[model samples]
Target: MMTSQTTTNGRLSKRVQEIKPSGIRRFFDLASKMENIISLGVGEPDFVTPWNVREASISSLERGFTAYSANAGIIELRREIAAYMDRRFSVQYDPEQEILVTVGASEAIDIGMRAILDEGDEVIIVEPSFVSYAPLVQMAGGVPVAVGTKIEDDFKVSAEQIEAAITPKTKVIMLSFPNNPTGTTMNAAEMHGIAALAERYDLLVFSDEIYAELSYDADHVSFASLAGMKERTILISGFSKAFAMTGWRLGFVLAPPDLLAAMLKIHQYSLMCAPTMAQYGALEALQSGMDDVERMKQSYKQRRNFVVKSFAEIGLECHIPGGAFYAFPSIASTGLSSEQFAEKLLLEERVAVVPGHVFGEGGEGHIRCSYATSMENLEQAVKRINRLLERL
Candidate 1:
């Protein structure tokens, strides 16, 4: 065999080059190498996929359902998702024309942005949000306009803020609740106000409600449920957070027919469909996994109480998060930056947490701790964090 040298003149896409890696990954990467490091870093449920959901996937594989599904998704799964949405949120979506299955809510975010955004179009993202939204917007040739939500305001983006952020170039308002990183959620009234703002501004709303099933104090309100909002909102949700099926990589989006068609085209070109077996599993989850979802929610609720109480006892300022598995505590008393506090906690106490700033500038002087770990682990992690704080 002769040795050959290969050279390429092609350049990588400028959009991709400008996108930065997620800051949440940094703590996880470091924690992986440390001995006995108690990680409250990643925003993932600690529970396994329920046995019934797993069995459904097993049954699909046994039946040799390993082939590709429709570019949108299996019809039965979409119908089940539609039914589930109607039953749970009273949001009716036509599965046949308004829904598309995605590899995950992550992909739904990407494709939704890709379908609607033109170069320099602005997307108002409420921060601190999941790390992916802004970069994904940038990669889709859109400008990410972050509206900072403060702890003083319970991290909820107000309608007034949304109105102020709207420019003539604004094409979308990307909102998430039961939010990641902050564990905040919006009520129906709050969401209605946002929908009104979006409608007034003539902007599409990309609502990420992936944590819809995990709320503790109140029900998750879908912006798409508001009257007149459905026509302009693309709702993205999935089985990952609620059903403990993160590894399954199944998610779906519900939108108007025209937008669905556009997103489906991009989804088809980028990802043929969500994984076949995962789609089957999600179908089962939507139909028969209500009990499983409730059980996980209760567990998370208990953990949330424990973590919040423990942090409060130690004089750390934290709110009782209404949804999701995270506790965002202010680190102002320690006089350390979010990143510095996270680093010191990891290095000194072998406890891992993500800095608030990792989420966005609004996250300064704060840190996010996930109570997704077992109660015992959460207690120990809290103790360790308290000890670290006292030494400061």
Candidate 2:
């Protein structure tokens, strides 16, 4: 096998070379090989795809519907997504002109950034967030300007911060909520403020709401649903988080017709379309899997409570996450840096959590622990973590 160093291409793209491996991947890789390791590292849901959704994919295969879909994705799926968005969130998007299904939410982010950014443009990223946003921006020749959300503020980014970060070269505000890593979400007021700021600055917004259906106590607000913001916001979401369909790799992007056209050009040249079977599965999910979605959300909510309470008892300052499956807890009192704490926990206690600093600079004193594992695993991990803290 040719090595990366000895490959015929000789040199990798500067963008590819500059990108670091995801921090979340590192702990999971190490933990996976260890006996009795309790991993709260990966962000994927533990639930299997709902039987109905799986049957839809199986049905598609039986019908031989296994070819390249339209570059913009199946029209019926897009229409279903549009209807779901409208019914669930009151967001209006024309299925034909506004939606493009992609390989995953990850691809939607990549295509959205590539379609709008020119060299040297700046994208405002609210951090500590999902690991991909900044690197993706760099790859597209755009600069990522990270705005740190404070723990004191429940990890919500304010309009004042957004206004402060805007420069003449600012092209987009990349927003994620309920966010990964932090598991924090913005309320209607906060989202409206961001929408207002985007309008005031004449900036495009890329809102990642993959966790929209996973909010525990509160409702998830879509930036694109705000008045006037829909025209400027590219909304990214998927079946992975809410429907436990991470392996399905089906997601969609919604934007104005002009923006969708530009993104379709890139999607066509690059990915062609999302997986056909996954698209069919997602179609079934949106149309008939509401009960399944609710079941998964309720399970996550129970897990969230268990983890949060356990962390609190362990003297870790866990900001009760309003959404998503991860818990962000302050580990500063451990007298260990986030990386040090994560490494030590994995090595000694056989519990895996991601270092907060891996998400961004402001994430230094905290760590992200996912509650996506079995309740049995979570209980044991908590016991081990408590013992580790006592020893420290």
Candidate 3:
């Protein structure tokens, strides 16, 4: 498919060229064109956005709230976000000065890094985590130092490891409890240690709590809610995972006054405000959406139990995740590299699960299986995995 003309077609910036494509996306693209593919790869919820949430957007359109309201987004949505945080996490933020709506948590991640990092600044990220953290740091011109978390630690990041990784150049500690890929969560006592470390090092913290509402039989201790951490932590969450509003492209960042202003400056020029109708949908979700969240959470809980139990029954050791909708099961027992196991399973069973190494080095012997789908799919994927494991 390649020719000399193609090779010479265009030049990419060194920054762009140096970065590798996302590990999570490769399998996604491959699965898209395949027949009868049962994917446990993508992380979005299988549930449709609730009718009430859709109605809210439709009502907003009927009322002609089509124009972009403010660069900071509409005051009403911001106020609802502030209230929701206080009510749910006990973290108080000023709607006017402390919160900025973003185009999904993805943009919040980018702007948060861009607003603060200078050349050569270092950020410590715990892995295996969401695929974007390290890449975002690099794109923002900061060095990303990954601290690997183990299954024995319940994948809760260790403050000691984080402290050991910090350098004089280190500026931010990015937290992703109810973490992606691993579905791990930290309790209050565990989080206090991380908070203490941040205090000792005087590091800024960015906590992505988009999965806060998805915890199962575990309390999600928000880094921002910990003692003396609010001033230093930028808490980012959105309606995507919990409210089933991923396509709405709505997310928000909460920070102290000065940091919020800096990120807002970048956001204003970059994304303008998030989509007006989407904001309305998010506002409705935040206001009356807890019921839908609870409904989905219950469904995920049932699926989680199913997948974890199924994996165990078939001789695969799976860490029982406390939050989020994924189960990161170790595939080391099969004596196959994560990639090989995933590829073989896909070819043999027509099932798609992400190979863990794509998440980072820590994920090499594991695979991340999302339970955010129908119970029937979960059952079928388990059966397929069981068949493959038996043969191996």
Candidate 4:
């Protein structure tokens, strides 16, 4: 579909006109229509919502708890979320003022940007990161200045890079640790450097920690938990990744009260509240799903091992990702670009993976393969990918 950029009249906002479609969706859509496709392209967890969580939502429905919740979400869910934060990450928030539930982390990201940014305010987006980040910043009337990280660096953005990217108009740092596409988490030293930069520059941080619960080799660090950071950071996370509740469409933000109040104004008008039943389900997840999270994480770790080993067997250099369920392997030696390798692999071997070039910057010449599927699918896809590499 053509964007509003090509509209008959000048009705669309220039900011909206400037945004590009998500790169992740294109391959997912193409793979959806094809048969015999073993897709490691999508980053969704293969697990279903746990029985306890689903039952909670069903029970809520049975009790006729189907009304518009307060815009910040049902107090119970928010309170549970607050408790979970303190328990899991040593971070605390006031459920009454610091948290606002939204449709998903996606919405929280957008509204968080909108609430904080004025026209031409700059947001430093590190890459190869999530595809939606830069577009969201631009749609919020902010300039998305991209800084890239390298494979040797384990895809972690260094303080020097962030400092170099910042300018007089720089106002926000968009951070996604256990990052999508690359699946790397930050070390304490890295975090300390970034926190120092943010503190010294007085920059606000928009931290997306959706994959926080999926870390493998290292523990996930909450940016807001850093000293001198809680007040300046707005963190977004949800049940989608850890609790396998993607279709439930629920997530929330943790920010200082005043900032949350501003985002809430935008959220209440646009979304009203997160899905009531979804919030109930999420509340259940926070209350009793730790065992389920551990199970899913173990499964992902197993799959990650297989993917990393298979890439090595094919003579592709792939760093073992510290967290999340993805492995980004370089396709440079194959004499094919990331897109060319992905497309040709799908056509020739019926194995689908995301071209890293779609993620921009350091992503070029690499491809992202998600191990969030079953062991069976992961093995088959890797075998097929290896075969394609051999033939090439």
TM-score of each: 0.96, 0.97, 0.97, 0.97
**Which ten contiguous residues of candidate 3 have the minimum total lDDT?**
5-14
Off by over 4 Å in 4: 1-11
lDDT of 3 at 3: 80
Residue-level lDDT tens digits of model 3 in 1-392: 78875675455566666688997787888788889989999899999999999999999999999998788889999999999998988999999999999999999999999999998999999999899999899999999999998887778787889999989999999989798999998888888888898899899999999999999996667888888999999999998998998888889999999999999999988878899999999889989999999999999999999899989899888889988899999999999999999999888998999999988899989999998888888888999999999899
Per residue, candidate 4 scores C-alpha lDDT tens digits across 191-260 of: 9999999999999999999999998887788999999899999999998888999898888899999999
What would the per-residue lDDT of candidate 2 be over residues 204-266, giving only the tens digit for each residue?
A: 999999999999988888888788988989999998999999988888999999999999999
Q: Which stretches of candidate 2 lie over 4 Å from their true place?
A: 1-10
Alpha-carbon RMSD to native, per candidate: 3.0, 2.2, 1.8, 2.1
lDDT of each: 0.90, 0.91, 0.91, 0.90
For TM-score, the strongest prediction is: 3
The CA-based lDDT of model 3 is what?
Answer: 0.91
Which digits, one per residue and each the tens of the lDDT, describe model 1 over residues 1-392? 33332122135565676778778788888889899899898778888999888999999999999999999999999898888999999999998999999988999999999999999999999999888988999988999999999988999988999889889999999998988889999898877778888778888999999999999998778888888999999999988889998888888899999999999999888888888999888888888889988988999999899888989999999977899899999999999999999999999999999999978899998999988999889989988988987888
327 Cα displacement, candidate 4 (Å): 0.9
